[model samples]
Target chain A: GIQVEQSPPDLILQEGANSTLRCNFSDSVNNLQWFHQNPWGQLINLFYIPSGTKQNGRLSATTVATERYSLLYISSSQTTDSGVYFCAVEPRDSSYKLIFGSGTRLLVRP
Target chain B: GAGVSQSPSNKVTEKGKDVELRCDPISGHTALYWYRQSLGQGLEFLIYFQGNSAPDKSGLPSDRFSAERTGGSVSTLTIQRTQQEDSAVYLCASSPLAGGIQYFGAGTRLSVL
Candidate 1:
């Protein structure tokens, strides 16, 4: 089993603010993804970056696999982004199971 | 036709009772997974099913928890003699054979009293 740690357990920001969330893994991974759990309890897929960088809309993510760490950036944050952001990774040895981090809870106030 | 769908959006069961949660994965997807999200907690891996073959049940928390996938399309997670600690959101996800970008269901919120 691998350990995934997320930093800045809680975050609060203005509607137009920006922030970065980090996830560090204990070992190499073959699959890495960022998910946003909405207030309605739907886990939305944000990124599927096992390595390198990717961006969608006002959100972006970078995974430095060699360093066993990943970062998620939210620019021009909106109230809809308020929820729990989780990082999950599957070790190279595992086939389909993903180990998840405790997640960073974000709140954007309008 | 669409994203992963789960049945019985919410379930409330008495302690020591048994309950079943169902998950219908995306069409043509070969990988299905079950996870549990406790209150204010992260998602915990429960089980994984790929195509046919035996499933990886290593993540199941206890003997009381079990899951089965039929025809590689639908899955059912059963909790026997459930306890108060069994209260949580059970989420199901599916990925294509390439195993990239998993799509999740709305999840079944289970409450054991």
Candidate 2:
């Protein structure tokens, strides 16, 4: 059922500013993740990038999986990095299940 | 606990009564998942164990829902007669195979009044 489109669903920065959350998946995926539902929900497991770059510290990710998209980069931003920022995948028949998107609701403001 | 250990973080059943959510994986995990987040939506795909056998329950959201997993490392998600949209937040994850990288827990906020 692959179809996860997450973009500027909502965001508002200030802390240090620097955001760029985007995940677009409609097909081809072996497993690509980037979660961080903090603010209590606790899904935190940022970046699993199914391809290419990856960083942690200030958070960083980038998966191009043949243009299926995946990018979550929240640099200097703090305030506990706000919340909501999901982007899951596992397409390609999806056995172990994982298909979430409709997220990206930052809001950092110290 | 080394991660992925959900239990009664919160639950309040009533509607039809019959709730049982538990999960504890992460000791040589063999893939286990079950998600469901409602309030703001996103994250719903409720079932997939690979040790005690459960080949993608295909997001259980019917038949009053059900789940299993025994000696392979605990897992139970039963919602027999519950309603009220079944409340929400019931996540539980673990992965050490079958498309690894999953580790989550700190969920289980049923509440079906």
Q: TM-score of every model?
A: 0.97, 0.34
Off by over 4 Å in 2: A1-61, A66-71, A83-87, A95-110, B1-11, B14-16, B19-34, B37-44, B47-56, B59-78, B81-88, B91-108, B111-113
Which number leads on DockQ? 1
Best by TM-score: 1
lDDT of 1 at A55: 93
lDDT of model 2, residue A77: 97
Clashing pairs in 1: none
Chain A of model 2, TM-score against the native?
A: 0.34
What CA RMSD would candidate 1 show? 1.2
Worst 10 residues of 1 chain B by lDDT: B39-48
Clashes of each: 0, 0
Look at candidate 2 and tell me the lDDT of residue B72: 78
lDDT of 1 by residue, B19-100 (tens): 9999999999999999999966668889989887788898899999999998889999999999999999999999996467
